[model samples]
Target chain A: MLPVIEAGTGPFTQPPTINPAVTADWLVAFLQDEMRARRSVAKAVIGLSGGVDSAVTAFLCARALGPENVHAIRMPYKHSSPASLADAQLVTDALGIHQHTVEITGAVDGYLQLEPEADARRRGNVMARVRMVVLFDQSAKYAALPVGTGNKTERLLGYFTWHADDTPPINPIGDLYKSQVWELARYLGVPRELIEKAPSADLEADQTDESDLGITYARADAILSHMLEGYSNEQLAERGFTEHDVRLVRRRLDGTHWKRHLPTTAMLTNTAINEFYLRPVDF
Target chain B: MEPPVNLDHRAAPLRVAIVQSKPRKGRYEENLRELGEVFAQLTAAQPAPDLVILPEAALTGYFLEGAVYELALDARRFAADLARTWHEAAGGATVDIACGFFENAGGTYYNSAVYVEVEHGKHCVRHVHRKMFLPTYGVFDEERFLSRGRRLQTFETRFGTMALLICEDVWHAIMPTIAAVKGARVLIVPSAAPGRGIEEDDELGSIARWREILHATAAEHGVYLLYAGLAGFEGGKGMTGSSRVVGPRGRTIVQAPALGAHIVRATLDMREIDLARATLPLLGDLGAVLPDLLLDEELPLPRGLHASGH
Candidate 1:
């Protein structure tokens, strides 16, 4: 959901991704040093979503750490789109990485049976969490760490299930928005079908992110960014958005603020974790 | 050691390699491979050249019309790749490379020369000279596609102080003059000029005109001039390949035969620039004649030069 500047020359405006030269150098340096120092391993494991986000992440990982040092895992449920599996295989084959297809049908269904009255959203969350379990297990066996595929637009919108897609040791694509992901996907040489496919959580049949959100990511990202810059509710409506939609988004923004932060503890001690203890993500 | 263009050893001498290449019109990747092969050959030579010059639009051929922009190079990624190829082929030898291509700059297409220097597998683009004079008559319609360059400046490289100008930029004396004034010891023209007219010597029209300008510029400025020309036939436009290196005394050191691929090399004496200027004092007196100072004050034209404004 980022504004595409200078877009007419190609499908993308300017690629929102980092410059190829700078990115290649930094990522390679970062991955090699961090793997040796922090993880004591030389490999990375990534769950492949049939989406641009994961493909791009995997592509960079392959470049930073050689394809031999990267493992691609595809965890699909019975209801997962067949195209997603094909796309995951496409990336793994292209990068020549070690590939594993772990079907989470049994694990997801086992959790779903305990709460048979759960809606599609609740069941989808279970499937996502189950896939994470499979990914982490593969990571440990391969002496690698799972790579996060969730992007900024999804994170900003609270589109991902907590502790599922969000829980990863490394996430290079998280800071990029959905629209920016398309630009990077093109630059990274990800499959066109994967980039162009309608983005979906694949929780239920015929469920698209835009259709569920009731707003296009293109418009929503622009508004969200403007809002974050302290655009008033009136200003946002003036720009574009019905009063109703603005109210819905504003309320969601207020409601989801907690999701963006680490869990807060009761301030019963001399110092809070927020104030005293701070740990930066590495490795 | 320089890159592949040494005749003999001399103190502070600059060895220049001029590669006259024929680009497969609109094929950027193929041209790069060909350049890689040339670089491989150069790497094997004793006393490798200090500077390697490739023809104008060597990355993508000139006269591409509408598709030139589409073929306009992405210098960053392209340079990184070409640098790796050079390092691998050259066995990690460092060389300053000046070559031409259509550049995509701020959504505008520019006929440009990208000067790259690679050392130990790392590369840096030293200068990007967008074409200043875009011809728009006869077989030339560059202005239709290319955005004109705003500056005519020179840069310092590992070898020596140098300046790069695209094909038509050399046609206008002021462009080369500006570069000479900017402390450039070597004036480089990466050209895509086509051969014209039939002569007993095969050097006539465009080739002859180019030689005249190159010699005059080099002799006057006391600077070595390298003209790297494109040699190819694309859609009936035959590019003239009279790529040559002219000394400060207006002497032609080595020139590629017209309309053919060649690798011309010559060793330049840096002290000769001082010798020539000291003997002639023309470049020395350049400050009194014209110092590139701008004056907005309007002066009435001389009688015979123009019609009376009144």
Candidate 2:
């Protein structure tokens, strides 16, 4: 019998699971082909946030293009958790990849000082985008392509700041859900502390992802997977998920549909890009 | 048309090669160049393949969307191109090739496969099969871009009667059934199936499903089944590459790896088709009642029952 990774408690009689070994091989091939063959780039640069998603991406990149070719950049704001940096360091040291620590506090505050009364949400978005800037600039300096670390769960829920966390040219983990990423993190031998810690955007102090979303990744992933399979809220409730959890997941999924796509373009001409005129990304 | 070679004394075992290729999306010229290089290498091998089968959209990658029109070549021109490449590489070596590509038939476009006999630097277009089923659901918009083919045809080669089916064509049972009834002893399927669904198996869900379908179809029809799968990623969607050759008894002869570019070969004896039919005889039974079944399909629905459920 094939080994299955059991995602903890949910309405699912059989928990959603992936074969991490197969997934890792496929994802590494994806990175190698997308980077070396399609984009003609031999090196990759990723924003290592000391989180499971980014750490998994780093491991895949290091495997795809050797550790010497994969570059990890940590861009931390002043209030960013020190443990985040330490955890990220654990990955780079373990993999023997090039590591760069760029402080984004000065860059972020220079713009924030202009809008002194910006709220925490706005501040977080700025920090995320500043990290994006640092990551992309480093990519240019290192002659590498910027790889995205956003997971499918965050992408479907629209939890990421637009044009920031999702701005990279390619992402190996974007198709894997958050829980699946954790499974892959374990398989790839990511530092256990990073995998075990609460997932956070780390935009503000003590901002755990589950607390902000009001649903655990395990539960949300179960609901999302079932919903994508064309199950209704009634069906989900029948399957034992609470109505409240189902509605919240559905709302976030439906409301954030726009976040998953390119900007809406006015299609005055028949040849408007990404609309009437369509082409694959690799094309 | 005259037979390309002598047909009477053709008792030799047919040697076939399935090239699990990774065609670059929308880069037709580059893919042709790479294919030419593969052809050169195959030609240099000691026991070179008599027939080479490549996956669907072997000249241009699958998932071309609107760019299918830009990369499509007419059948005659495509055959000439392959023959020219072969001539330059091997200098008048004879080999038959079956590969899929987007076809430009006049102004209309089709997802098509062409069989060409490249002999002594000249080529003959044996047949071109256009895909009948254009899956337009999730992750597929084929119907929006190309027209469907209307006919199911089986043609004669030196080995025997053979039929070619594109990816979605073989998904429907009727396609292979009709081909078998038309006297095809060999079935060639060129597919660009995307790897999808992670389940309880080590293989992708798509690959597992395909394996079941291929085995059943080959066993039922009592024909040698050759499946060529596309490899590599097209817009992040990886094509599952498990190119295989299945015997008439539905047993896998040789299978390629599931991820990368590869070429898997197998030698087939035509006598196996006879032995499989003698053992099971499923194809004989189906052929006996096929004409009546076709007539039954033409009849109207029963009283109080519409085609769609009320």
For the second chain, the TM-scores of the candidates in order are 0.89, 0.94
What is the TM-score of chain A, computed separately for every candidate?
Answer: 0.86, 0.95
Q: Which pairs clash in model 1?
A: B2-B48, B2-B49, B3-B48, B3-B49, B4-B48, B4-B49
Q: Single out the weakest 10-residue window by summed lDDT for candidate 2 chain B.
A: B3-12
Q: lDDT tens digits, residues B1-310, model 2? A: 7865446423467878888898777878888888888887777775778888999998788999888889889999998988888788878888889999899999899999999998888789999999999899999999999999989999888888899999889999999999999989899999999989898368888999999899999999899999999999988899998899988889777788777788787767666687678778999899888768766745774534455556
Candidate 2 DockQ vs. native: 0.01
Best by TM-score: 2
Fnat of candidate 1, please? 0.00
- On the 0 to 100 scale, the lDDT of residue B213 in model 1 is 90
Error of 2 at A252 (Å): 76
**Model 1, B189-282: lDDT tens per residue?**
8998876777637566778888889999898888888889998887887898888888777867778877667788776766667666766777
- The digit string of per-residue lDDT tens for model 1 on A1-283 reads 1111110212111223346556545655766666767777788889887777888888888987889989998888998889888988889888898888898999888877899999877888888888888989999998888888898888888888888999987677777678777777787788888888888887888889998888777766666665664556775565455677667667767778777776776787656665666566550
Q: What lDDT does candidate 1 reach at residue B87?
A: 85
Query: Which portions of model 2 show Cα errors greater than 4 Å?
Result: A1-283, B5-10, B297-310
Model 2 clash pairs?
none
